[model samples]
Every structure is written in structure tokens, then in C-alpha cells.
Target: MNTTPSMTLERQRADAASARRPEPKPATGSFQTVEPRLEIAPAGATGGELVDRYGEILTPAALEFLAALHDRFAGTRHELLAERLQTRVDAANGRDPRFMPETAWIRDDASWRVAGPGPGLEDRRVEITGPTDRKMAINALNSGAKVWLADQEDATSPTWANVVEGQLTLFDFLRGDLGYTSPEGKQYRVTAEETPTIVMRPRGWHLVEKHLTFHDRAGRAMHASGSLVDFGLYFFHNAKALIGSGRGPYFYLPKLESHREAKLWNDIFVFAQDALGIPQGTIRATVLIETIQAAFQMDEILYELREHCAGLNAGRWDYIFSIVKTFRSRGRRWVFPDRKAITMTVPFMRAYTELLVQTCHKRGAHAIGGMSAFIPNRRDPEVTERALAAVTADKRREAGDGFDGTWVAHPDLIPTARAEFDAVLGDRPNQVDRLRDDVEVAASDLLDIPSIGGEVTEAGVRDNVSIAIRYLESWLRGVGAAAIDNLMEDAATAEISRSQIWQWLDNNTVTAEGTRIDQTSIVRLMAEAVAALPRFEGDRFDDAISVFRTVALEPEFPTFLTVGAYARFL
Candidate 1:
């Protein structure tokens, strides 16, 4: 079937947006940072001037490409976001998600396989993840892991400087010319031979690039999809060069709730490949089955993206966040214990990971495991040893459970994770052949949240309050991921921390110390936690406390705190 004229025009716009190389001189001046400029200022799209230094990135063609993506797919994205609410309502009202019956054929057929792993992605036993700052980017790439996840979603605070400078960093990284020197005189440079392969994880679909706006047919100003802006700029600039160098443009798709969302991504991949005149399967992506709804549809998700699919990941943090968000209103039966108590070994989490391994191997894809978010505490050798042991044990279990690989937040943990997987994998690139036929999981198993019952203690409550405020303060200061209390904390950590409080308050639960989580106690704890926190020199410290209180004490749960917080700050 032929597409409508509008879609055709959209395709043309995207195709025309690919930047042609003619070596435009770098913008010169003492650059004053500003909002990105609009070259093709459509009726509803306008913005502040782009800094002269970033002009090469925000060229007329690049903005048009992002505009095209907004015009063509933004409507469907809105409908999908709306549908998530209905899905949650149905789930709460006894329509719990199971394997879809209609897609049985897709699962039963055994011959279909995803395109094999691209050049540098063959053995992904250890991958390090971090934000795209100049120093961190160099450190992560130089980390011994096989892949470095240049993260824009959880690891990045999407300030205007972060958004624009991140694009510039990736462009420079890919060109083998990126370098940075700290004020203390530590120099960093890319290790061409030893650098891990790059896999960019864009902001999730739920986020919008507030710095750039696109107009719709009705002349309404709409925030361009964060995913599009990140993916478009990277692909537009680096696709051909990466392909020529034997590594193609790779991605880690985050926060998908359903197979339909995966289908939308597959369509986007198809359009992106065609528009750029690349091979259909050139762009490979691994879907992070992070949502509760997505856990039930792993098979369908891989099937939808088979041509462009790499694998599925156990996005543990957001998976927990999804569980809380989906069943927040279902009362005490679904009330979870402390965040630390919900380990991967729990029956429900075990079932989810087992199902993921089985589904991925059955369909010829890698099964990646959860993040071991243990940041080493260098000040205390005993602390570092314990964290290392725990990380080692976690990777050991994942490798034994048939996972092809796992993730680490710090470079120090890479050797530990790699050692465990190395013992299992040996010389093999991946264990995709380990089809887990013995495992069987059901809907009740996935929804079994209360099975691992532990006491919610005063310490846990204080920890939640403490982590939320500190993480948010760091986030507002333009750092997304931080090491607090010897643990790596990100946006997902803050979300779970706050939402768990809201759930406990909503259910009127008492802590192990006999403290009720009413609004009064919550406010008191917030004040105490803020006081206990080290004084950071900024008004945003207070802002973090206020935001944390509103989200934790409000009657209605906020879908995502970052969405509102972004509007206020970024």
C-alpha cells in the first residue's frame, strides 16, 4: 500500500536532512552558549540561537531531519503514551498481561533469526555505562569492557549544555579526535586499538528535547522527541563513517512498555535506513525490556525488530520502577519492601530473567543481564572487597543462568564481570545457542511482588529520602548518575525511592520501627534527610527537597518526576 502524501513528504524531508560532507569551517568566536537555532523555521517551531561552536551540528539539514521525524511519528507516539494508561488500568482491574495469543505463530515458528551481531558487538561479556561528558566518555571507551554504552537517558542530566555538548562529544569520539584535559592536569585520549565499541542509548520515548521544538499541521509548538533528536543527530553524522570502519550505528532502546512500541521502533529503523540509503539491517538495536508490560512481550518485541534486532536486556532498575508505577493504586497486597530487598534472586525477578534468556536464545539473540550498581568505595578496602564479591556473585549467577553478558556501572567491576562470563563463555563469542527449554513462567510468577517479604525499616525510609534528595540535587546541577552511599544512583533510583514512599503512604503501611508513613512523618523525614545531607552550595538543594516531598506526599502519583522537573529547570 502506498503512503499518504504527508508521509511521503516526511520521508523526503528525512532523506534530504542527511548532512553531505563539504568540510564547513568550525564556527569561530568566544562561544556564548545559547539554545539551538532553527534553520528551517516552520510555523510552530522556533528557538534561541545556536552557539557558534555547535553550528556544524545544528546545520539546516539536521534540524529538518529531526522535524521530519517529529512530523511523521510524533502522533503515534502520543497515542501510545495515552494507551499506556488504559493498559495500566486494565492490568489493575484483573486484565493482567500474559503472552499474547494472537502472536503465537511468531513464537512457534523456529526458523526466523535476527541479523547476526555486528563487527565489534560479537562478544559483549562486559559493558560499562556512563554519561557523555568529555572525560567520562574517554574513560568509558578506554575501559576494558567490550562495549561502552554512551548513555543519554538515565546517566545524563538533560541540561541544554548537556544536550548540545553531548552531540559534539560523540561526533568527536567517532572521528578519533576527541580529547580532554582536567583542570588538575590529567589528560585523556581515545585508545583506538583498545577502546570498546560504542553503543549509544538515547533518552527514552517519555522524554522530550525541550531545547528544540517542532510544529504540527495545526501550528502548535511541540517538543521534539528526545529519542529522535539524539538518534537522528548521531546517525546523520556518523552512520556512514562507522559503517565504513566496520562498526555500524548501534543503539540500546530503553523504556519500551509493549511490543507495539518495539514495532514503532522497527518502523523507524526501516525508515531511517531507507532515508539514509543504508542497508535495511545496518542499524542494530537491543531492546531493554524494562517495563512490566514489556516483560510479557519479549518474544514479540524481538520478532518485531528481528531484521534490526540485536537482543533484549533485563533493565532491572526501571523494571522495578515499572512494577511500582503499574500497580501503585492496587492497595496493600502489592506493597513492596525496601528497594534493596528486591534482588534478582526473588522468585518473580528470577522468572523474568529466566524467561528473557529462554526467549532470546530460542530466537537467536543475546540475553544481557541486569546492572550491578555497586560503585567501589576506594577509601575503605573492606568496602571495595565486599562490593566486588557481591558483583562477582551476581555476574556468576547471570553467566550460569545462560545470560550472554551483563552490565557494570564502574570500569573497576568490568574485570570481575568479565572473569565470570569468561569462565562460562571461554573462546565462544556468545552463548545464544543455550536455549533454556527447561524454564517455564506464568503471569502470576511475574506479578508475584509480595512473595519476597521483608520489613520496611526506618533505615530504609531514611535511605530513600536521603538518596532522592542527593540524586535530585546532583541531577539539577547537571549530573544524572552519582555515587552516593557507595551505590550508583540515577534517575531510576530516585523514581523507585520516591514512588515506594508514595505507595507506602497510600497503603498506610507502618515501618518495621512502628512509624506510619503519613504525610506528617514524610515531611519530618524529608527535613531530617535534607539536614543530614552535606551542604551543597546551591538553591537547587532546596528545590530537590521540595520536588521530592511533592512527589512522595501527593495524593496522585506522578508518572515521572523528571518530566515535570525538566520543564522547571531545563
Candidate 2:
């Protein structure tokens, strides 16, 4: 369990790397930008006294905490995001991303490892992921799982009410007050004996918390980073309570594209802990190597956060989305055939996970597998059996490949996922000592796009179109995670679905049935896809179709469909 002799040196190096980027003096600045716009109102409420509804938690001190984070880090965040555009441009011009030679020292230093998992994060074999709404939060807590990923990012829509109330839900959950009553008079409660450990996931770095604005001394008003707002408020309110209960504020950091971003988070953690008078490593984070850029620097990313790092998660959906977005402009070789064909077993994806497991175990970190898409159908026995069998095979492969744990969406898939891990990891909290040294992955292995076998089919196109429109409709209606065709579709689903359509049409792809994919065909399919949905008085199908066309049928590809749609709708 011992790591390297120097966690401080990495911080010093990060500090030096970010020295050129200007940060504010301290966490003491007043972020009063036009009288505190971070207040929330329930959906459909025109006007009422809304301050007292959430005034208990969004106090002066919490707002100050958020301002301090923006003052010190938001400028640097802008620079990093701007750098992404240039990277994509370079990638489009026949430049494949390679491992950073500058950070080889971090990767070469095998003695350095991420900090061991904090309390309640040791055995994460069956972690259920869902939104932080009151009812869903209660269900996830009592779902008989080891960890509940209280996701405020991908699984949640960034509505004014949803964002603020999610924090209230967390505040309530830790104090044994996360209870709910259904319209049918059904009660939901969490018992100490039955509840799972909570590991919250905030929004990604690319998102902005529009409600919280900060006006600088230069007289420019900018929105606060969603990452900062979510992490800052949660840490300010609950770090001490979680620490008091013997479990630290554990987190699943999503959508990090570089080690520099990891370094920024490390600095944020250091500052927040220091501000709160907590210990240096009291906070623990597990980075998701979801981006293709992050996949190439997994070692450096872990090293950057080694002092407060727990492990790494294989975020399969976003990773694939990143691939499509990264290589999207590069011609026919990079065009993905079908969304369903690109499973974890594909050569490139297998390379990504294999390298992740080897890198994490070599440095004494947990290598967690991605989520399983095996949502059980309650009414059909045959469908339930198929779901279980598929989940069993998926988890078995992960366990066999040296994954310490795996993720399942539904509670019904837990026994199947846990049994596979139990078969491999009996009596041990994890398999960190199982060194996968035989896995020698090259840059070419991770970029093996042509190795996957499958052709574009008409069913795949129709499904993508249908899912994109339907998912966006739900998202625009403030529902981020929706189950369509027995799969939990989140923002990542929309990104991949739209990105694939863009890539196929851009490359003039033909389906296996000899049908050409073009803007005309896509427009026709969009009408069919939208027409299939039920008509209601307040349906957002029109907006959803517009969003789909803007992102999928446009001349230039958009990085994330959620970004533009969020601006116009949420």
C-alpha cells in the first residue's frame, strides 16, 4: 500500500506549470455580481419568496467559497478549454495524439501511487449510478449496493431547481433525513444498515453554472464553472460531516481531458482543504479516463492527483464519444459503423481498458470497469434471463481482466455483477496487487479503429435518430437520464448518437442495405423519428428536432450537443 516518497514535488511542478496563468490573490474576494443570481425556483413557479426555500444551505460563506474557487482557477480553466479547439484542429490534420514526453517522469516513476481509497470506498464492486433527485437518491442509497454514485452531471439536467435541490438532497442524506413520499402515498427511507456509501460526481469542466455569475475587477461578468460551483458548495457544506462520520468526501471526477486539468483539481482540493482547516489529503477523487486525450495520459493524470487520488474508472460511453469527436473530421477510416457494434471488446476499447488496469495496478490504484447496459425487463421472463446472462458475461470479462469492480445500472443486475467479482476477488476488497504486466499496449493499439468489424445498417441509423430526438426532448424537459429501449440514456448518449450521424453523413457512408447517408436522408428520418413519439400539449419535439439537426446535420461538428442545447433550453 506504500507509495512514492514525494507527493509534494508533483504539486510544486503543477504550481510551476500553471505559473504563467494568472490567478487571483486569495479566496477572500467578494463575488457580488449583480446581487446573487444563484437562487433556485421550482419549475413552473412564476414568482414567490424563493430565498427561504434554499436559504439554509446557500449561505454567504458557501457563496464565498465558490467565488474563491472562480477567482483562483476560472481563468486557467478558460485557457485549457481554448486549448481544446487547437488540439482538435491538429488532430484533424493527420496528427494522432501521443503520450506526453514531458510527463514521462511521472509515468516512469513506478514507486508513486494514488492515495488508498478513503473510508467506505474500498469495495466498490457494485456501484449504482443515478441522479441526485430526492426519490432516486433514496432508491440508490438503499439499492443493496456498495456505493451510490450521486451523479449531478451526466444523470442530471442543470435546471435551476434541480441543481440547487440536489445539494439539499445530499445535505439531507448525510443527516438521515433523505426521505420521500410518492403521489400514491408510498414512503421511501434509508436505513443505516441498508444504505450504501455516497460518492458524488459533479459536472464536467466544460459546463458553466449560468445562475452563478462573477464580475471581475476588469468589469467582465462571466458565469462560474459548473465544476467549481458543484464541488465548492458540496465541500463547503458536507466535508466536515462526512469526515466526522469516518468517511471522507469521495468524488468521481468526470470528463478530464488532460493531466493539467487534474493538476488544477489537485490545487483546488489543496486550497479547499486548507480553507476548511481539514487535512491535506482528506478528499479523495477517482478520475474517469473518458476522453481520448486523458486515455493517453492516465499515468500522469493519476500522478497529478496522487495525494488525493483513489483510482480510475473506464467511462465507456464518453470515451467512445471522445473518439468520434476527436477523429471526427479525419476521413473515412475513422467513421464508426454503428453505435451498437462498438462494445468494450473491440480492439481499441480493449486496449484502453487493458492499459488502464495495468497502469492503475502497477501504481497500487483500483481499476474499475464501465457500466453494463443490461437493464432488466420486469414483465418478461425471457428478457430478464437475457439481461442477466449478458451482464454475467460482461462482469466476468471485467473480473477476468483484472478489474477491481464493475458498475451496474439496475439493482437486478447487482447480484450478477457482484457474483462475478466475488468469484475472482473473494475476501479481498480489491485486486490492486494483481499486476497486469503482460499487457503491452502501444499508441497504435489504442488507435486501432479499423480493427472493429461491422457495417452500418439501416436499423442503426433509425435507432440513432430516434434516440437522439427522444433523449433531447426529455433532457430539454429537465430529465437528463431516460430509459428508452431498456437502456438508460444520458447526455453522453446524445453526444455519441449525434456525432455518429454527423460522421456518417460527412463521409457519405452507405448502409449495408445500400442506402446512402446524407442530409436529405437524415432529414427524412428525423420526421419519422419525431412522428413516432406521442403528441402532447407541451412536447419539445420541435426543439429536439432543431437541436438534432444543428448538431448532427451541420457542416461542422459540435463538440457536445448538450452545450448548445443547454444554453437555448435550460
Candidate 3:
């Protein structure tokens, strides 16, 4: 939180530039910048010359919009994040999560509907998600899906280079000129006559962008919110362009815990549109009901962002991780079985998804389902077939249960997912009209994990350690989503994997093989995992081991391992 003397001087210089700059004529579209006082300087931690191409996306107008967003909403974001910590503490001390008594009116009111889907978001049967690297961007856009969730959050490592490059990549994609020639001399581009609609997922509210530091009114150097930076840059530069193309700035909001957080996003959207001179509801966002508390507040969340809301998504990995984090202190009563056992078929998960579909359709919003994290392996035909079949079954279940759409991490799995949805949807764009009046889920149903039982296995423990370490190493090496043993492993998955180990240790969990897991056993497993992974030339794997040790074995569990682990990048 402290700023060095040099950073202070840099902040002063930037402040002076803002003070001296004069108001400028607006840009040539409905959205424009009235004043151009923004000057961005690197925060000195990850200093490297940005590519000249980055200038195309990080224009003065874009930075000014970001500055305005930070000025208006960063304080509220800070307060909300603090509120999250307190809320978690309260939940730990027996403050049960239930539908808010005060928000019952909003939930009961069935007359209102979220502003209907914008142009490109109408029929999102299948959405491919990935970090916005150039090749992946081209592949995802070209994938035969209706939408691509261009991710900058969990799917991406927040390296300075990755952040800026992602912006530039998206900028190029919007212009319809984004393409990549692989090192093997193969070319990739958006070959489809109608490429997938893009929905960008910015970093969650908890993460910060250390590379872009701003000063508060008290003259303290503060890291910019990653959410603001990602949303600001994309919207500032591309809102009008996307609007012209009949597609607007669509987003996927992640890890929100309450309606208040959704309200914050709504306020930010309103402010951003107003500042840029765009229409009031030009932005559309789908909130990921990934947290347990968020699952309870679906209707209220939709109401908060109704004007700009697209729908709600059921996120698998993060939803499981949230369960562990929120109820870790509640003893074996909240203890989970093996991560593999808690599938979509489980009672609690089914309750959550059924309630989500009912709530979204009841409010005339699309209910998207969780990701199918199966990546096909080229060498193993058998494995690929099995994975595709599993993906098919999952999508079939979602479609049958009235989900409008779902997510796939790899392009190869898109067709399998799309086919399942097609069988249900046929000619319909979405099942928002499927009110799902037959479903009724209670608070107890959502918290019924204890009843669905299985034992922790040594294989489960070793798999958790192996996957976490591998994913963390890749993350530290500037790759957020890594394909380890055919599954797409992201920060959310890693969080679950590592946190389960922590929980198992905290509760003195006995594996099915009658072996008790303790700190020493976990350390031995960690060493074995490290030995199994192929050694690279650098210290990234070592650093990942230490980070895993801290998060998995430390006395107190950190809310998000990425928060502390990211500092190692700096």
C-alpha cells in the first residue's frame, strides 16, 4: 500500500499534466471524450517498453475514461471488498446465508424483466472461454460457437505484458483484422462468415493491477482495480465500434457475492456509458453465480443489473471453491468429499442449478450453465472420445434442465456442446420463456453437501496437489489456464484443489484407504508431484512449490491464493 519516492514523483507529474490539459473536442461518434487529461505511467514494478501497437488501444481517451472510472467508483470497490472479508468472517461465526428478508419485494415482483439481450447475444448456445492470446483469440472467435468469453481474469495471468497485449488483441479482433501465423507456418483467423460474439470477463473485484497505479485524494499510491482497468480500456475504445456492428460491449462479471456488488457494477456501467456519451443501457453483462452467497441472491442480483443484465451463469470450479472457502470453519458438517465426486448430479449442486434456471426464467433472463473443462488430446483417440461423450452428457443435462447455454474451454468441444443445446432449442433462441415453475429450492437444499457423501482418497489428495502445483507454475510463468492431463485448469480450479487440501488437513480427514492426511503427508505429496512434473530451466516451479506450501499448509487460509501469489510476479 505504500508508494516509493520515485512513484510519488511520477504521480505528481501525472497530476500536473491532468491539471494543465485543456478540454478537447469530442471524438467522432456517439461516445466521446470531453477532456483529455489522462497520462499513464508504468508503476515501476513491471517496467518494459510497451509495443508500439499497444498505443492503438491505450489511447488518451481510453486512459481518461479509466481515470474517470477509478475516480468515481474505486472507493466503493474498496469498501465492497472490505465488506466481503467481514461478511465471510460473519458467515464463519454462524451467520447463515439465506434470501435477504429486505429484498423479498424485488424477488416477488415478477412483472419486471432484464433489458432484453442485445444483438449478438441473442442465441448463446455455446460459448468458448480462454485467455485472449492472439492464437487463442483467433481460434475461439472462429470456433463454431455463438459467443466467445474472452477472459482476462482467472483464465489469464496478470503479467503486465499479458494485460496490455490482451487489450491490443481484443482491439484488433473488434476491427476484424485479428489473425495469427503460428511458429509452424500455419495461419489462423476468424474464417467463419459470422464469427462468435465476444463477451469479455474482466478480473474480479478482489484483484489489483500493480502495473497501473493511481493516486487517491490523500495522495497515496493505489493499485488500479483490475476490473476497472479491463472494463474501462475495452469499453472506452470499442463501445462505438461494437455498437456500429450491432454488437455492444458485452461482459461476464465474475465472483460477485451479493446484490450490492451487482449494484456497484450497474452504477459503473451507467457512469461509463454517460461519460463516453453512449446510450444508458449500451452495456450488457451476465453475472457468474459462482459463489454460494450469490446463488442465494440470484433474483436480487438480476434486479440490481436488470437494465444491463443479460443473464446468470453457473460456474462449476469457482462455485465448489466458494463452498469450501465460505464454510471451511464449520467443521465436518460442511466438509466435502473428493472434488471429483461433487458433480453436477450431486444434490446441492443440482439444487443450485435448478434454482438458478427457475430464477432466471422467472425474471425473463437466460440461465447459462457451468463450463465443461474437457480438452481433446490429439494422440489418444479413446481419451478424446470419452471426453467428448462426457461433454455431450453434461450439455444434454443442462439443456434438458432448461439452461439457455453453457461454456466450453476448448474449441474442439464446442460442436459437441452446441449439438446438445440444438437438440433442445431447435429454433428457439433461448428458453427464457421456460419459467420452470415446477422447481422450488430451499436454503437447506443449497447447503445439503453433508448428505451427499464420499470419502477422500489418496489419489484425490495427490491429484489435488499435482494439479495445483502445475497450474500455479504455469500461472507464475504467465499462463493462467493450463491444460494439465486433458482438463483446463484455471485459478478457480486450483483454488478448489488447494483449498480442499487445507480443509482436509484442518478437519483431520481420513482418506478412503485409512490413511490420515496431515502437514507432513501433504509435504511429501507435494515433493512427489514436483518430481513427477518435468523440470524446466527456471525457478518458476520452485516458486510455485513455495506458494502452494504457503496457501495449502499455512495456519490461516487466504481468501484467494492469487492475491498473494501475484506479488511474486512483481
User: Candidate 1: misplaced stretches above 4 Å?
Assistant: 1-49
lDDT of 2 by residue, 415-444 (tens): 899999999999999999999989999999
C-alpha TM-score for every candidate = 0.91, 0.92, 0.92
Q: Pairs clashing in candidate 1? A: none
* Candidate 1 per-residue C-alpha lDDT over 351-468 given as tens digits, one digit per residue, 9 for 90 to 100: 9999999999988898989898787887899889989999999999999999999999998898899999999999998999999899999889999988978988888888888889
TM-score of 1: 0.91
Model 3 segments more than 4 A misplaced: 1-45
Off by over 4 Å in 2: 1-52
TM-score of 2: 0.92
| lDDT (CA) per prediction | 0.83, 0.84, 0.85
Report residue 239 deviation for candidate 3 (angstroms). Answer: 0.6
Tens digits of per-residue lDDT, candidate 3, 1-570, equal 111223333443443343331122234655533332334555465553456687776776677777778767777786677667666666776787898899999988879999868989999999999999999888887788899999999999988788989998988877878888889999887788888888999999988887666654434456678899999998888889899888999999999999999999999999988888998988999999999989989999999999999999999789999999888767778878888888999999999999999999988888998887777898999889989998999999999999999999988898899899999999999988988899989999999988778889999999999999999999998999999988889999999999999889888888999998898999999899888777868748889999998898886677899989986664
Lowest lDDT 10-residue stretch of candidate 2: 1-10
Instruction: Between candidates 1 and 2, name the one with more favorable lDDT.
Output: 2
